[model samples]
Target: MNATEKFYLPVDGIFDMFTSLTSPSAVTHPVVQSAVAPQQHPKAPSFSKTGMGIIRMVKESWRQPMAHRSSSSSTGRQLSIERQAKRSVDLLELGLAKPKNCHRIVVLGAARVGKTNILQRFLGNDFDESYAPTAEDFHRKLFHIGGDAYQVDLLDAASERNFPAKRRLSILTGDTFLLVFSLDDRESLHHVRDMLDEIAAAKAKLLKLKHPAKVPAVICGNKADLTSPGAVTRSEVTQALGKDVTYFETSAKDGTGLEGAFRALAALGGLPDETSPSRHQLISLLSYQTLCISQRGRGGLRARGHGAPCAAMDPLARRPSFTSDLRLLLKSGSNKNNKPEMCHVQ
Candidate 1:
C-alpha cells in the first residue's frame, strides 16, 4: 500500500498487533484485508482522562522562569540569574522563606526491563525477585538537598508487550524522563527511540508551541549488574544517544546507581546537585540540627546514622545544597563530523 493510503483497522484487532508511529509518512495503524476504506474523518481514539491530565500537568509545570534576581554586579551573579531564568517558574524561591520545590520523573521502557525494580530500590530500599505486571503507578518521595524542599514523583509505566494504550499515554507526565532499557536485550533500546519520537509529538500537541522541548532526559541501562563481558559501555551509550540526555548504568537488584539516577533526574528538574554537599557543610548541618533537636527536648537521636528520623523531623534539618547545572547534553560522538560539546555543570 502507498504511504499516504488510508487503511481501516478492525475494532477487535486494534488492541493487538498494532502500534502507532508519530512520523507522518509512517504507518499509523495496522491494516486488515477485510477492512473498508477509512472514512474521511478519522475517528478519534478513546483517550484516558488520566493520561491527558498527566500530559497537561507536565506541560503546565514547564513555564517561563520568574525573575529571581533583578541585578548583581559580579559575573557569577549574572550567570546564576541567567541559569535560574531557564528553569520552570514553579521553582522560584522566596527570600529566606521555605524553598519551593517539585519534580516529576517518569520511567519507561520495554517489559521486564526493571522499571518497577528501579523505583522500589530507590524509594523503599527494597527489591523483589517476583515479576508483577503493572499498568501504571505513581509514588511521591520527599527529599532535602541543600536545605531546599524537593518533592519528587516517580511514575512507573507499564511496558509489558501488552501494556495498555492508556497507561503508556499517562507516562508523559514527567518533567524529566528515564528511558530504562535492559543491558541484555538490545531490542529494548529501540523502545527508547520510539518513545523519544512519541514524546516529541506529545509535547508539541500539549504545549501548542512550535519550539522544541528543553526537558532533560536520562538513558538508564538497567540490569547492568547482570551484564557480562560483551555488554555495552558508557562510551557506546553516549555515541548511540546524543544530545539532551545523560546515560547511567544501574542494577535494581543490588541498588547500584539507583540513588545517583534518582538524584540526577531531580537535578534536571532543578533539584540539589549530585556532587554537592561537601563533607564539612554536611557535618555542620547535622551538628546544628542535632543541637536544635536536643534543645527542643525531642532527643531520640543517636550519634551515628544520618538516616535516622531526626534528619527528617528536625526544623533545622535543611542545609545549603548547591544546584548543579546538569546540562549533560552530549553534542556528538568523536567519530561524528561535529566537534565535541563540553559537558558543563554550574
Candidate 2:
C-alpha cells in the first residue's frame, strides 16, 4: 500500500477497536428513553417560597447545561491515555530514582592563584605541566572526603581584575566555598578581601531565604611549598584571615598540605566522618584491594619472586608514582591528553 493508505489503515483499525470496546446499548438506551417520554411544557412559578428554595432552583438550573456539555466515556478514555503517556515519559527521564546526596563545593580565587590546580590535585590527583587559563566554569570527578560524596565545581576566572559579577553569583550558590590565595604572589593575597566580600554578599542573599544556615566558607592558602622562611609568613595569612575562618596551606606540586585542606573543608560541610562504616567506605575499601594486588601480591608476596626480600615487597617499590595510580582510579577514562591544568600567578 501507499504511505497514505498504510497510515489510514491503522487509524481505521483503531476506530473499529474503539467501537468494539464501547457498548452500543448504552447510547441507544438513553436516546430511546428520551423519545418515549411524553412532550410536556411546564408553566413558570408565580412566587418564590423561602430564600433556600430559590437558591436551590438556581443551582439546579446552572448545573443542567454543564452536565450536558461534559465528556462521555469515550472522550474520558482518550484523555486518560494521553495523560498516562506524558507521565510515563516524565518518569523515564527522571529515572524514578531518588537523587544521591551530593555536596556542591566551589573553588574561588583571583586569576592564576592555583585554584584550579588545587581542585585538580584533589579531584584528579595529577598536576599539569603547562598552565592554560579557565574561560568559564569547569568540573572534575566527584571525591568522597570524610564519608560523604561531593561534587566539586571549580570556577577559576581569567583575571582577578575582570571577575564576572554573574559568575560570583553562581559560585555563591554552592553549599561551601574554598577561597584560595597564592602564597608566592602578594597581589593575589591583597585581592582576598574583595573575594571574601563577594562571598559574603552571596551568603547574605541566601540568608534572606527560608533556610539561612546551609552555607559555609573556607580560606585556603596555596603554594605552601614556596613557604620557606622570609618568603610569605604564615603569621601574615593568619592575621589577614582572622581566627574564625578555616585556613589551610596547600601545595599542588608536592602534594603538601592538600589532604588536610580538603578534610577541613569536608568537616566544615558536615560530611560524615571517614571512620563511619558507610557504603562509600565499603566501596573505597574494595577498590583498594585492586591496588594491593598490583602493588603487593597475595600475602605480601613480591611480584618479582617469592624468595625476594620482605622490605623489597613494598607497594611503593612496584608503583613508583602513587599519584598516577590514584589518577587512574579517579579519572573516568585513560585519556593521555588529559593533563591537569595549573593556575599560578606570574
Candidate 3:
C-alpha cells in the first residue's frame, strides 16, 4: 500500500467502529444518530472493539495541551496580582507625605576608612565586620517634626572619589559633608586634605564668594579603637585639617562619638532639632501615622504623643541614578543665588 493508504488505515478502522456502534440494527438503541454516516465499503476492515480505545486516547492527547495552557495563564495572572499587592503594601508603609525640606549629606573618604561603618551607625545599624569596597551608597531618613516632614539623604562616596568630575558634582550638590580618615593611615589624611581643597574650590565657584568660607562640613578621624603607636596624633590631625573645621575622633567599632558628630552635622545644616538621632523616637510607619492623627486631634506637633516627633526609615532605599543626581544638582543650583555652569565631564 502507498503511504497515504497506510496513514488512512487506522482512521478508516475508527470510522467503521463508530458506524457499527450507531447502526440501526445494533443491540443498543437508546441513543439516536445525529448525522448520517459515510458509505461503508465491503473491503474495509471489520470494526474492532479495540478501535474505541484508540479514539479515546487520541481525544485525550488533544485535550492535554489546552488544559495545560489554561493552567499556565491562570498562574501568570495570580503572580501579577501578588506583585501588585506587594507594591501597595510597600507604599502604605513608606509614607505618602511630601517632605518640607531635604538635606543632602555626602560622606567622602578613601576606601576602607570605615566610612560605611560610620554611616551604618548613624542609621541605627550595628557595625559590619565584613569589609567591602563601595561604589556609591545612599540612605534616607525621614523625620516628622513640628508638623513637618524633613528628609536626609546620606551618600557614601567611596570609589567615586577617584573620578574628579563626579566627586566635584557631589561636593557642589552636597548641603553637608563628612570627611573621614583613619588614624592608622596618614596617606588617607592627605587624601582628606585634598578633598577639602576641592570642596572649597567647588563651593567658591558656585556661591561666587570673594573667598570660600568654611562650608558646612565635619572632619572625622575614624578607627580610634585601634592601638597603633604609629597612628597620627589628634593634635597633628587638628593642625593638618586646620582649627576652623569641626573635627571629631570616632570609633566605629566602639560606637563612640558618632552621635555627637551627627548632631553637629544637623546643626550646621540648619536642620530641625529633632533631626538629631537622640532627639526623636524611631517608630514604625503605622504607629507614626497613628501618633500624627492623635496629635492633630489634640494640637499640633508639640501635643501628647507628638512631643518627641516620629522617625521612619526605608530599609530598601537606594542611591539615585547618575542622571537623577545631576538633575538634583541643577535644581539645587537654580535655588541658590547663582546657577553653576554645566560642563562636560568625561
Which candidate number has the best TM-score? 3
Tens digit of lDDT per residue, candidate 1, span 1-346? 6878886644333433222221224343435322322533243222323334554555455433334334445556446545543432222232211333555677778888888877766555468889988643666544333443345556665443355444434433457788888888777777776776666665554454587454477778999889487776766666566654777888988877766776677577776553221211222223433333343344332232333221111222121112211211232112256654433211
Over the stretch 250-279, how does candidate 2's per-residue lDDT look in tens digits? 787887777777777667666543412222
Question: In model 3, where is the ten-residue run with the lowest total lDDT?
Answer: 27-36
Model 1: CA > 4 A from native? 1-100, 144-148, 159-172, 233-236, 273-346
Ranking by TM-score: 3, 1, 2
Q: Point out where model 3 deviates above 4 Å.
A: 1-100, 286-307, 334-346
Candidate 1 local distance difference test against the native: 0.53
| Residue 293's lDDT in candidate 3 | 50
Error of 1 at 90 (Å): 16
Q: What lDDT does the true structure give each of the candidates?
A: 0.53, 0.49, 0.71
lDDT of 3 by residue, 1-346 (tens): 2345432335545545565764446433222222223435443334434556677777677678875655777678656545543321222233433433667899989888999989878777789899988744878776778775567888887668568787777777788899999999999999898888878878876665688657788989999999999999978887888888898889999977887788899888877767766678787644554554555566544443335566866555677667876776666556446765564233
